[model samples]
Target: MDTHSRSFAKALSWRATGTIDTMIISLVITGSIKLAAAIGATEVVTKSLLYYLHERAWLKIPYGRKTAS
Candidate 1:
């Protein structure tokens, strides 16, 4: 493992059990639940884009080398 990977893993860990992640999850869940109501519109497009962006943004974080600590 390298520094970049470590940092990325750290970022994911942070996102997994925090306020930011909770909000993201909630948003996605709600959007999916409401998809039927919004058929074909900006809402679906925006939700799709947001999900992609969120994944890509997290991918940018660097995972680092392992440490004794």
Candidate 2:
């Protein structure tokens, strides 16, 4: 498993990207800045937790991972 900080940073970066994308999509579909921002805010928190857990889980599985020299 990777260090908590590494996983957290990765999650934060991924969540930032995902939140931007979500905001764009939500804005286009909903045509409401407030609604879009709300959706983005929700995704930022929920997806960050999900992404961190997902990364941790993947780190535990050794399949297809190469060992460092």
Candidate 3:
């Protein structure tokens, strides 16, 4: 495969593994908290990006949280 394709494949594999791990962790945490379903990769990535921007002061308004302070 080409370099870009290889890189993308590697990223995909890594993301898949991370998703699985996140799912398992989410399952445990949610079970403890009595939450419903385990969040997926999309949600985790989106939340992380939002938090990064928030920490950078780029996102002043809360994106996912119930209250924005």
lDDT string for model 3 (1-69, tens) is 135445445555665676667777877767642232346646556655554444445234456656546
Tell me model 1's lDDT, rounded to 2 decimals.
0.51
- Per-candidate Cα lDDT values, in order, are 0.51, 0.94, 0.54
By TM-score, who's the top model here?
2
Q: List the residue pairs that clash in candidate 2.
A: none
The order by descending TM-score is 2, 3, 1
| Alpha carbon RMSD to native, model 3 | 13.0
Please list the residue runs of candidate 3 whose C-alpha ends up more than 4 Å from where it truly belongs after superposition: 32-38, 43-69
Per-residue accuracy of model 1 over 9-55 as CA lDDT, tens digit each:
65445533443444555557776635533433444445545555565
For every model shown, what is its TM-score relative to the native structure? 0.32, 0.90, 0.47
- Weakest 10 consecutive residues of candidate 1 by summed lDDT: 36-45
Q: Which ten residues in a row have the lowest lDDT in candidate 2?
A: 59-68
4-29, model 2: which lDDT tens digit per residue? Answer: 99999999998999899999999999
Give the Å shift of residue 7 in candidate 1: 20
